[model samples]
Target: MKQFDVERPGRAEREDRPITTTTPTHRLLPHPRDLVRFGPHDGAHRPAARVAVSVLVPLVVLATIGHVEWAPYAVFGAFASAFGRGLPRFQRLEMQLEAGLVLVACVVLGTVLAASSAPVWLLVVTIGLVAGLTSAVSDLRRWSPPGPLFFVFGLGVSAFVPATASTVAVAGVVAPASLGLALLASVAGALLPAGRRALATAEGRRWRRGPRPVDGRRTVVHAAVCLVASIAAGLLSLALSVESPYWAMVSAVVPVVGSATAGQLVRAGHRLLGTLVGVALAALLLAWHPGVAALILAFGVLQFATELLIVRNYGLALVFITPMALGMRALGGAPVDVGALVAARTADTAIGVGVVVVVLLATHRLRRPRPEAAA
Candidate 1:
């Protein structure tokens, strides 16, 4: 894996002469239409096109997720390859971890809340707020999601827990279904071209190559900070919470550290804020329409909309992420929990962010970097 370096370039390289020997790794790939710009609304089509695409992709992909075999996966994979024909080889993978975490959290909470029967709703809520918060915090380290770490954390925790109400029927269906959807979501996140591609298309920008600019290289240090921070946040909150709050605090703070202090921190903050708001709104919606259909539509449309806004700004993505996570959690089954869940989600989000910020501050002080001159 390539990373950025901040030291001075080679003596000859700094003299403004071109480096003729560009290797395959250094070669610039053709950026998609949106990679060079921002704001998808600048496209000929409004953001509505994204929404339409989202609705269709999910229905189709999830049909596969819910399907009996791998044929759907093959067809979809082929189509995605064709669609992303010339995209970069290593597009930053974000949603993979997020979706996987959601699934893992769902499975874990399901096992907890639904052990004897389908009512581990309390655990579901706790995991949502906590894990979602953790995911957001992980961004601070600038570590993107979709890493294998989520799969381990999500699946591992649940596996070790007591097995009761997570019956064969429920486990068999829920595990496969959740795993399938996680895969579909990753494909969508990768293939959709949300960040740079979306930006380029929005501006109709093109590249006239010049210098190969450097990127952030504090990743190792940042990641270490985030991991320590997450555990600290989890422990602190666990001690503070009395009833359900105990689980909420314990489960939530890891994602912050998981991201390890790159741009992920900003996105995580956005997601955490959105989740807080979403959880509150979900409570209201639950009060009004507690049926499964209402949740399905609410989550579906919001996911589509979130993707649209996510193309423009990170804040918008969180609006939908919050609710969708809470909704997916219902896989463990529903409960009469609207108010407390939302409140706890808000609190947990705060804890995660606070922990990440503190860690970042401490780390910065410990390893102070030389200040760069302003242009």
Candidate 2:
């Protein structure tokens, strides 16, 4: 780590501190090099496969029992199985449980709100607030999968659920059931050798559970930006008469929250590319008009591929993610509009990416002052 001292307007002389070089300082536009940079595809195969299995089993069971409407709920619950990826067993289990509960709450609340008579603007604001809170929590927890991406996804999807007694009742039942199943899968995942390693890591951390320094201000700003951007994107989507504005909100939050402007720009590009291809794939699949069995299988495979590629590249992940989300929607008994859905997704992503970029540019200079300048 290298120490640096950049000056601030009124701050007292500060002690030497390490400055992260991975992210560039106060850039108005993305560097050209960043646009071409891509993370290596280095996801662990076994863990990803486990996540797919965890999500798949519940979805299959729900579909087989003619509860295809509950498939999305199960998917939300199984989302926890994707956590603790590279962690030891006990830690992984704890991570899964915590994340699962959060997802359950997000899904239930989003569903209830969407089903309510609340104004569309209100719904958008509420979703943004929830996303901010989730972002803060995720940062504090240092969750592996990172950020409020899934939280936003859950809220966005639930926003579409029409407010009805039957719908609410279904949400009440299916949400918890899915969460429970995810928890079980988390425990079962420990049976593998990789799980043992994660357990050992957890034990080591437990002994040293001392506080680790976190940038509260940065976290808050990140959360706030996510909230504002998501809300803005959702509103824009509504203005454009898009059926599901939440997707736009979600697309904005994901790329804009954590990384530098350059990194976000790259990610935004990846999101756009992956989504376009994914939607095309989804259209092809929709053309087949597959039954519940085919949908279930496809969901599992797509999820598996997504987990495998997500960390390496968000764009590639979206290739599978787009179809999986569409598949979930289709199976939920909702009317699938391939053309509208594809268009909405692309448009919303563009809106979100643009909002986040603008926000980052506006706020770049507001970052904490470097001690070097003060000297």
Candidate 3:
């Protein structure tokens, strides 16, 4: 073997040599393995049970009272508490209460706008602006529901309901009913023997609360940009004569609100794929046109399944979510055009994902370079 020079660099030589550092790998999208990984099995059945009860009870009562038109209000209202499901019991309670308040405000506002007989364009603009504002608040507070999904859902669904002076009365009923039931259900879990341990843990942690690190200001900016983009995408759908522009707006919101750029990309893929499969299921359900009782049971089952699968996979959750939403809308008296709705939703989702990708690229370039200290 040839002899090699093994002398180490002198201190002066080492100091003068330019240091080469390894760059941290940051993928613009998740790896295929990341996309499929179901990292942990976190059982969410308790909260699922609560949500099913909360949603179904009010809906059943409204339908029984022949206030079927108001069922959408209660359904949307109850969804307010659907956030914070995985939190420690007391934290979940606090989070849901705050979320419920916000949901009430949003629901009431949507009702007012829908009742105003305003032009559709004005309504879209109003929703976009309100959603952006609410998203900012939600992020700053670190609320679990995150972003403007449910708020926009409430607004979009409410816009379809015939708004009158009586609508305010309906809102009063549904909003309170939703909030109260959700609170009761949320708290009820803590009374369970298993949940009691979590409640105690939360109690100990409650007073120890310190400032949680967050870039709240940056979050607000990102959420606002994302919401505005979603609105634009929704408007585009309307212009293109798509049947359900709101679905596009919702889809757009879903991706951009993800935890990371990689997460967002994964979410966009899940959204598109999930919605495609979901719409197929929805098509079959719509074709069947099941009666009220059947719809109620179906809603309950789907809601349970959605909760069960949500943590396991986003795509899986959407499969149930799509049919549940379509069923709820049909129940709320909106005409269902299964084929057109599915096509429009697919198109809108693609458009929304495109907007998110564009925003991500712009934001990436604008991000200030972090100063790296020498090792």
TM-score of 2: 0.85
- Residue 362, candidate 3: alpha-carbon lDDT: 61
Local accuracy by lDDT, each model = 0.40, 0.70, 0.67
RMSDs, each prediction? 12.7, 7.5, 11.6
In the range 1-375, model 1's lDDT, one tens digit per residue, is 111111112321211111111112212221222122233332212223333343344434544455312211121221121111112222212323334344445454545543544333334334444444443333332222211224223432343234665343444454545444434432443334443354344221322212343223333454355445545555555556622332233333332322123333443455465566677766666677544545556655765565455435545556665665455444234464666667666776677567656665555433334345111
Residues 227-332 of candidate 3: C-alpha lDDT, one tens digit per residue:
6777787788788877656667777777655434566666677778888889889889988888777888888888888876665677778899888887776785
Candidate 2 local lDDT, 1-375, one digit each (tens): 010111121111010110111345444455545533454443346567778888888887887788777666667777887776655445566777888889888888877887776788888888889888998887787666667888888877776766565776777788778777766765664455654454454352342223557767767877887888888888988898877788888887776545455555666667777888898998888867887788889988898898777665567778897888877768866677777777777777777777776776676665534577446
**Model 2 lDDT at residue 199:** 43
Identify the superior model by TM-score, candidate 1 or candidate 3. Answer: 3
Q: What shift in Å separates residue 61 of candidate 1 from its native position after superposition? A: 11
Model 1, which residues run further than 4 Å from truth? 1-217, 242-272, 329-333, 365-375
- Per-candidate TM-scores read 0.50, 0.85, 0.85
* Model 1 TM-score, all chains together: 0.50
